[model samples]
Target: MPPASLPPLPLSTAAGYQARHLLVLPGDVLVDEVETLAVSRFAGARWDVVPAGVEPATVAPRTAAPGEPGVLRTSRHTTLTGPFAPGPGLPPGSAMVFDVVTPRERGEAAFPGSGDRDGLGRAFPAGLPEKEERRAVDWLVEAARRLGGSIAVDVPSSGAPGIVLTPDPGVAVDMTLYSDVWLEPDAAQAVLGQVDGRIRLAMDGVDWQGPPAGIADKPLYRGEQMDPAVRKQIHAAADDVDIAALTSGEPLDGYGLLLDLGVDGMIAVEIGDEPDLPFLLRGLPWAAGGAVSYRVRWEPDDLAASQDEFPPMEYTVARKRSAGIVAALAKALHGAVGGEIADEAGFLVEPDDL
Candidate 1:
């Protein structure tokens, strides 16, 4: 059992202040996977939708159902999960949430915390004692290696040790080792020459909690007004899913931060959902919902004979963009038939279009 000092949700609500660091996972993975990973080795690790009234935590291991509104009561943290839209029961505040991701979650360490300097509404919290720093990094690196997908991490301010693993395999310049700790010449070469080139060195307390950079250059515009930062983040996340679905053919995973800025209502997209990436650009009928939507459906009509090199096959394609305030302008301008042609259908919106 954790010490009595760690307050539960109800009590914390009354106090009116909640602090926590959100460890957002890769969208492709299931929430259950995150829960399972927490119990496998990192016991204090947990996820929540965050509460309102101004916000979200850990305990016995349990999982919340998709879109369910409730609290997970365990030995460690009392986590409240939900859509949190300030509905009938879900008021408007913010979820006071955190995960037991470090040694401190188990009562093993501590560190100094600080706010973001980039003018973004995020924080770079401190934790992980000297004895456990390397071990934590190693564990995180190993997890990244196993996941084999795009991932990133944030470290505390004060130049403490922290790293985020990305998929690009490019050695970024200005990588930080620790407080005033830059990679040595030999170490830098060795690091770059080594195996997977996905590791990213982070410093000054920043979280790699969004999509991989340049996942897609397309822009998505929403009519609903929101903070520019939040708008940009969600657009990037949508591009991530858009590329994944079109190329890799993966279903929409979902989008949102483990913790939100609490500055505006969330505008998110989820897999197995409507107003999704597919119907929007695929020229398929989109189910009406408050959210911007999309869909697509196609079948191989007939194979065309190619005289020279290309694949000896051809089929028709159709595409379109959403008409919402934050809709995508069909970039695949096939006669502007909503970005569709006789055999090909699609479009691309630049990042700046938003």
Candidate 2:
């Protein structure tokens, strides 16, 4: 079946604050199937429609009939949106909300812990216990496959922005890598060489350089002075102490490198093994167990034009380039040290997976 399309829904400030996921079904599905799906997953669970003005928390959930729309309360905090009309198109579809919040507060009081002050804390948040989030992701992936569709995340700020579960590989640039053994600076440099080679094979005559000489003299708009200085610092420190600080987290020590991809952007590579893997990359058993890993990221140049919201052509192109680059790097790393590559959505990346 062709891929289902999800029109960007208006972002609800209240519900949208937490990372939100939606399941987009490509074709029409009978309400019976939806019920069956819920039962299969939740085991004899019942769904009910909270009357027009009544709150979900206030009412007891009576069994919903086959064609009736309702809410499937999986737990006290999580609820999956019930069935809605599947619209028309060659790849016609409708989205079911997978919310990780209480129905009564509608996610207002969900996962409130945060030690991050002044934007310095772990990149991996303490929000929603990993166990709970994992349960949610597992169900979402299962639901998408059950419906012959894909999983999508509407939150752009998510670590895995523009993530969709599709067979035909598409670029999702933001990626993380977990390795069983520590890969040192020398090994990392070798991996960088491999990545550079792959990119050159794909794009002819692309420039490869570090922060240029006299970068300070160059205008910011020229994009000549582009350098991931912070990443470079992390890399130097990693060489000394071999631990890297996570986003918003304290800098201990770690190994990393930054390669300027010119127009595509700068790639930041950081290595650390102390912390558990980011939630987005823990789908696999071994990865979930945790190991030394590299967080490969693409930082777009500031001058790049903002992608148009409607068409998203520019954005698509940028992601393709960046994602392709990181994919190349992942393949190279896999070849070098024998590790797994995972995208932002935490799925193990196959060669065909972008």
Candidate 3:
């Protein structure tokens, strides 16, 4: 290494204070948890016990530079290494990090280790899946097996289903299946009243695209699925369509099965004209209320596509545990892709997000 003075851990690493040394423990299998709440908050939404000076709020996620080990991003500033590749001093197969810092204090320090540091102490490394995460994995596998097999029906994972929503209103969901399957504009509108009060599935906006011809026809609003060429002609004519009046029509039935069954996460899909395609599934957002959402992209990277490509299907899940939901999604996607989908960074950080 470079210096002997570095502590085993650090909070604001740039400041280099071991203020409760915050090392990414270089291992897995640490232990920790508690309290009860709604299934919505069942396992994800919780607080971390950090030192007074070590504000979790300010901390930012730090990962080894590209070509280095993968990052385990639990939250914004809280990402650390995953169990598979522990750092120095950490034993192989160590599920949790053993230790890091040596000193910390509540109030101001005479020596003065102060300031926001813009983030919290470096995140601690992860160990094994918590009880909940493990359960999520199991539940997803079972659900996938059932759905993939001849049982020939959708299975809702029982518990408070963690739902994911999109910012755009144009997306419609096929309730019969668990994942995000896109619907025609009419179909998307039909489910609104039914899912009233249900948590919206929040996404980071990269995974969406304009719906296909039939699905996107009769634009929901101006520019919604409107072709650029056609828009120019309309603009030349100075015409305005009453989008609201145009869209007001009778709602379709049976698309509410996803909400009706109450699943953890739903993936709505829109098929492209191309028969089979390769794509990327990026960003996993485990929301504040405890919903896990991710993006699925069909385009491959120019210089760095993976030999093992991403799977080509969209899906949803409602289940006993988000751990199961997250894990199952990962497993299914991972298995579907057959290996790995290379990211710009080359490290598969998104996969470990589960």
On lDDT, the leading prediction is 2
Name the candidate, 2 or 3, with the larger TM-score value: 2
- Kindly give the stretch of ten consecutive residues in candidate 2 with the minimal lDDT sum: 115-124
Q: Put down candidate 1 lDDT per residue, 296-348, tens digits, no spaces.
A: 11111221211111222221111011112112211211112222211011122
Of the candidates numbered 1 and 3, which has the greater TM-score value?
A: 3
Q: In order, what lDDT does every prediction score? A: 0.27, 0.50, 0.25
For each candidate in turn, the TM-score is 0.21, 0.45, 0.22
The collision pairs in model 2 are 120-248, 121-248, 121-249, 238-254, 243-253, 243-254, 244-253, 244-254, 280-346
Q: Model 2 scores what on Cα lDDT?
A: 0.50
- What RMSD, rounded to one decimal, does every model reach? 27.4, 15.6, 21.3
The regions of model 1 sitting more than 4 angstroms off are: 1-22, 42-129, 132-134, 148-164, 167-354
Ranking by TM-score: 2, 3, 1
- Decide which is better by lDDT, 2 or 3: 2
Model 3: per-residue Cα lDDT over 11-130, one tens digit each: 122222222111222122122210111111222322333221222322335423332322322323322221122223322332222122212223322222322111111111122222
